[model samples]
Target: MRRGWICFTFFATLAAMTRFSIPSSAIAVNRSGSGGPVIVSIPHAGRIYPPEILAAARVGREQLERLEDSWCDLIAGQAADRGATVVQAVWARAVADCNRGEGQMAPGEVALPLRAQFSAPGRKERAGLGVIPTRLADCGSLWRFPIDRHGLNWRLESFHRPYHVALSRELARARARFGHAVLIDLHSMPAIPAGQPGHGARIVVGDRFGRTADDRITAAVVEEVERLGVSVTRNQPYAGGHIVSAHGRPDRSIHAVQIEIDRSLYLHPDRSPDHRAVVRMSEWFGGLIERLAGIAPGEDEVPLAAE
Candidate 1:
């Protein structure tokens, strides 16, 4: 497997640069030139589970696999020569969900002493989808053992912290060189529920109700998806998550949005990538990146120095 990261995979004049880290290798950072203004974040595509994580699980591979975004990585796998940066985590989300914040742990998920670090568990955390997933719908209590302080720190340092740190750094670098930046936090979703607004939609774009990005970004996303002959919706049921909240700073010319692709559109029943669908989605993203790279933010959205 590709262990090292900080790479650049190009489209027109493509070149990939890699930097190596630890724990199932590191993230893949593919740049083009100065890495344009767009950064693509694949937080949940991780498939590699260390022996420790698998051994600690009460559920089998199928239930553990539920934590993955499946093959979401391939959607943006080849946005070459387009100057968009892609930061992809290779470790499985079951190891440590990258989209969740550090404080999302439940009181019972961690050892008693470390419980104070987290506030009251939110709906997601309580439901066993927190930073370190503790339960699933039918599979109650996911771990064979509780999360002690060493276990908690190991995950944070090895998985969660590294993913976010790399993402933040790349976003900052893109913004610095391009005068502004946008993060496309990518993920895959199960079919939307029957009554949901985006139930029949093939793609859903989220910007946390206009807080994480300019309206223009969302508009551009919707337009691009429609151009590919796919139905799209916005902020329906699934808005952006902790990744958007933590990195999006439109106030400073850095924008972020979450894009959820319905798995049925591109995955097999077993959650593997459908090659044809993957290629179509890849080309869709490639063209969209080119188009978006050309869209300038508002004049008032100046790049301010950090305070």
Candidate 2:
């Protein structure tokens, strides 16, 4: 029963972040026991898929596997115990990428195409990595049969909408409890060529070119993690994805940062992750949360431990 349960050291300062109860299921969220300034989002770390959709996808059990969040959930799951609320997707990313805008539609795709003009099919979509992937990596098709409108709606209703409803609710609740909130949209990048630009930093901290969030919060997160001896970079490779574009608004005092961790750090190219290395990374993140939790929007609060 250790599917999603993990333990961590607790601190009084961490008690500031509050925990929220969600319906019990594979997708259940584990909110921080304390109220803190940070909210960690693990959008792509899902593995559950509807039976029908799985059957339609022509891929073998292992072949369809390439599209998983791998172990991103286990790493980010630690956030909930460290004064940061964690929101994760229970349905598989192949069902729908929570990081993507609502417009993503795959024709005969399992999910109903929303009634909106999405960004035209660009690199991410053509390569079968859009909000709703049409294919898998290496130019592989995911479906044995074409998807229809009704089936798409079924997935939308059963999977997509429910996920966002939970996510939006969590964000709203956090903002209400705390004067301000910060969302860390967590994801993992393939060690191989994902077609994302730049050499790909081990950890890419994105703030949407300084538009979505404040500079100070961004600086604190990036600097704290880098101090842990990990190679970190800025907006070059990942300048935040749909979650950032949707929820990040520093003006409203609800900030979001997209943290893209390189898969190679913890996983091999074959898609298997090293659990011990992942825990090491997670422990480092715990220390970072301890530091970020002390951050103050105004000049009054004390600087972080290192400062």
Candidate 2's C-alpha runs over 4 A off are 1-26, 106-119, 192-197, 298-307
RMSD of each: 9.4, 10.3
Model 1 over residues 1-307: C-alpha lDDT tens digits? 2211111011111111212124547566777664578899998997888765766677897898888899898988776455688888888888788899988988888767888887689999888788988888888887766676656666677778888888889888878877788899999998888987778887899999999999988788889989989788899977899999999999998899999998977889988789999998898888778767777778432222220
Rate residue 48 of model 2 by lDDT: 74
lDDT of each: 0.80, 0.67
| Segments in model 1 whose C-alpha atoms lie over 4 Å from true places | 1-24, 299-307
In model 1, state the lDDT of residue 111. Answer: 68
Best by lDDT: 1
Task: Give the per-residue lDDT of model 2 (tens digit) for 1-307.
Answer: 2311111112111222322222234355677766566778787777777554565566766665577768887776467778887777777777667777656654333324432344366667666666666786574777653444444444455555666676677778877876677778888875425566546467888999888777888898789767867777788777898888888888887788888888877776666778888888888777777666666555444654422
